[model samples]
Target chain A: MAVYTHLGAEDLASLIATYDVGELVSAKGIAEGVSNSNWLIETTGADGAGARFILTMYERRIELDDLPFFLGLLDHLSAHGAPVPRTIHCRDGDAYQLIDGKAVALIEFLPGVSVDQPTPAQARAVGAALAEMHRAAHDFPMERANTLDIGESLRVLQHCGGNALATVDPALPEMIDHAARLSAAWPQGLPQAVCHTDLFPDNVLMRGSSVTGMIDFYFACTDAMAYDIAVTHAAWSFDKSGGRFDRAIGRALLAGYESVRPLDPVERQSLPVLAQGACLRFVASRAEDWLETPVDALVTRKDPMDYVRRLHFYAEAGDNPFHPAAD
Target chain B: MAVYTHLGAEDLASLIATYDVGELVSAKGIAEGVSNSNWLIETTGADGAGARFILTMYERRIELDDLPFFLGLLDHLSAHGAPVPRTIHCRDGDAYQLIDGKAVALIEFLPGVSVDQPTPAQARAVGAALAEMHRAAHDFPMERANTLDIGESLRVLQHCGGNALATVDPALPEMIDHAARLSAAWPQGLPQAVCHTDLFPDNVLMRGSSVTGMIDFYFACTDAMAYDIAVTHAAWSFDKSGGRFDRAIGRALLAGYESVRPLDPVERQSLPVLAQGACLRFVASRAEDWLETPVDALVTRKDPMDYVRRLHFYAEAGDNPFHPAAD
Candidate 1:
């Protein structure tokens, strides 16, 4: 959401020189991602001109050991013909470079904008891309746990306590109780794969309802594929604050997912509890961030109550939206 | 330093539509300017493709009525063959458009980077560009009073008082007395023009030793052109935090300015006080910002002590840097 690191034009040009990309023309800091800084880099190509890429500086919430996996996953996925951008290795074949003790990498810049009010067509394209990413990540020769899962969510939520939740909203403290119920009902032994756990609308880049790129893989990890669908459903099927649900977008997203990778009957039935867990996961994290984030962080703190509304909807309705009632 | 507004992709594409530039391909938020949100916009050119522009959304510290003067100054200078960007008017010929009750405009994107550690040649180029801008701005219809002048600086510094200055540096309070002396000695009426009062290294975009454009005109107003030189000298001739002075860069900058338009003998003699006034101007504002800027502001609170050190340097030896001492 903001550029935290201030790299000079010389440092950037030298870093770009590490690769085969010609001289740096311009680098503009992009307003994207919460935990890292990104720049849209334009350069003179090796032979011609106007080659563009994304330069990212890893800032926080990621460790040195995780760099290989994160950068490697892109190489693997893009190798499998997914629309994900490839991590451009340095001339020495290293995945990332260290500058002032921080890791930075150049990535292929995939064109298209992340939608705000995603149409049914856009939602469908994103669903299809998510499924494709899951398939493409099949042989990605590495593993990282879904660290921000239900257990992590509950831990963070409990830390918020009743007093802090009261500051955000009166009803937020009640999510602690509801989270416990979801934790108990949370299933095991369903279909699983390397899932893009945070595939919100903001992550999927689209051009006229055609999915061009799925980006920001810092939160990506090995997890239940069905749970990934649940996260996407909870994310894209509602208005920004989760106040209103769009059934068409929901059905289109689900159908698009099924068209590529059909869900098992168990996966279908589990959607009810999974969506609730997805919504609760947000409730816990948003509440923690609301309490703990510094006032001046470039991030916009999301209201925990937004997910609270979604959790209530999932709790009461179950899988009604998936069936797609005729309008 | 950070993007304050979040414009949707649809809103931005439509905004681009207002101009004859093609459809919006991408808009990357640039970390430029303290009080405005700027995006480096790339469009599919109306005839060809890949035309670039800068989209600016004014956020704070600038009034709506002042926009015409600011935007029109760029138009006036560029039309007169100064190395400045031209304002791209909307289809209805409006200089700026209102979106969500905020003003935004498109300007030609100039190529080159704002230098970090500027070389003497680079400083010289910026000096020439500044002088050219001052001359090109002649006969600009609109007039804006230099609001943040010596009087305003004194007012802000006085408000900070001893306690606030102590927080920044114990010596900062002593600047108030020095500012008063400079205020009393401040000479009246030197040669005046539309001055780009902020010609810092960061404001002048350069390709090697050549200046591509002079930018960030929000501070432009009808004022003493020599005072503008004083401001630029103070800004570019010192290192960041004002710890050390670069004599070659300082001499080159002044020489470059004289090459364009030689200073009046009266203006040359007034350099000492005008330069001290320039130093005090920043010390006052930075101290006020250091005291009052909110904790969560995306801006990094600059050390007022930086400018205080510069004030001391100018006070101890007036205008010596402008005249080169043989090595």
Candidate 2:
């Protein structure tokens, strides 16, 4: 839970005036994501109607230049009817602008609850939403290379080993080697499209097993769409501890994804390695956060061992449960 | 900003079932206050109506037995049309219950914006609301003693002297001495009532110049009504640095309070000492928090010296601003 930036009422009122959105009624910081400061803002429309929105102030971690891709992707996907927030345009015909020296954007508030441990049905709904977002953003004009690609993952893993990771878990070095091997030999991609790179369970909102929306598109980039499926599977099919895999939920999520856009034979065959890469991505990121983040930071870093165990599960499995046969 | 207790969706759903509120739609952890975990909960009502409520999970600092007094005071005040959140009772007729080993309660969501540095008009509105609440809660059946009374203040002052407070500011001891003197010489009986002991700027919500609500009554207790005014005066009439007092706002606040219930001569005479006591309470508590809170806590510990400076200003002033003739 974080709200890194604080804005005063007068500053907020002036910021609101720069947009077509009406008078600011209230803005309360929401402690959800770790990447940026988010506030739930309410305004009275010029027509005297009421509206609610989410005002995001990009923090230090996010690259300012990359915001256009994130905002444009949301704009493109929402226009295509995907379950995502629609960016509210500013008076200057841009969805993103500067407020108090930080890049700020407003998006319509999406209504739905994010669960810690989703039921199998809810897992499938999330899978369906990811697929929907992937399809919707396929033709998005912007492109951003994944910052934490295989090479970056290797760097993070090395950093973790040199730092305090071994003290936390002695198996980290060996796990890094295994992940490096899989990432180095990653299969040739069969399908590429816009993808939500970090579709964690908390990013998908559900209402009674129905997908309401997908949020936190900061990591969205042009990547192998099948890799997105693998990431979402890792997100939804894994238990909270990530030590155990739920095959039933994995199959359900795959089925949900297939309902929208079926995986081609090559894509299906690459699921295991892709899943390994996804696990490695999280493992390295979590390790870095655990080692690098200041003790005084208001962030709760996930245990890297959780992803370490998940990577092991992926390594031990000869074939993906969702795609049993190589194509 | 705190969300100390994390509740899973299944637990939340079951908890909602115990109430007639409705189907759970969403629950976002609100990053606002430092004392408790707060979630902005939305539900589709049992009758298919939509509603939003605040779900507060009481943290360790709060006493469980004192919850009845706090919740009952809100209930009583809101029932009498004072601007405060009404506690929502569960189907079992209890307003307080436990979820995930943490005591929790749901209250109706009041709509208004809370500001950091309130305008003079806004400060007056807040003062009016505080006065209204005091009048309405006068006959409240339950009573809790002010935990930060003169004796407690002296103890906290002593604790501050022995801690790292000197490292933060060398003048702390002198300020502590001054505060101790005022607290030890607190005036004898004036008007007493159930008071909202902490009426900080962030605790009051405003729409334009009108106060929409008063919140965070965890500190409410049986105390001198004049002391409550003094506490609020300290909260609203002082700048963040606490070095300079805004006399116009202070006068406006006193006028607003007098509009609802006039201050007796005895109460008026007690204002200076009471205000001094209020400053001391915040100074000691903030010092304790600064010394004890973990470095990684999500909370921002207020500088104790801000209150110390305010205590100094209160000490040096020959006349109470509220009582022009008194030194």
Q: Which ten residues in a row have the lowest lDDT in candidate 1 chain A?
A: A318-327
Tens-digit per-residue lDDT, B163-206, candidate 1: 87887888988888888888888889888899988888778877
Chain B, per-candidate TM-score: 0.96, 0.94
Model 1 spans > 4 angstroms off = A294-299, A324-327, B294-299, B325-327
lDDT for residue A238 in candidate 1, whole number 0-100: 93
Global CA lDDT computed for model 2: 0.82
Q: Judged by DockQ, which candidate is best?
A: 2
Docking class of 1: medium
* Candidate 1: residue B64 lDDT (0-100): 97
The per-model DockQ list reads 0.56, 0.63
RMSD of each: 1.9, 2.1
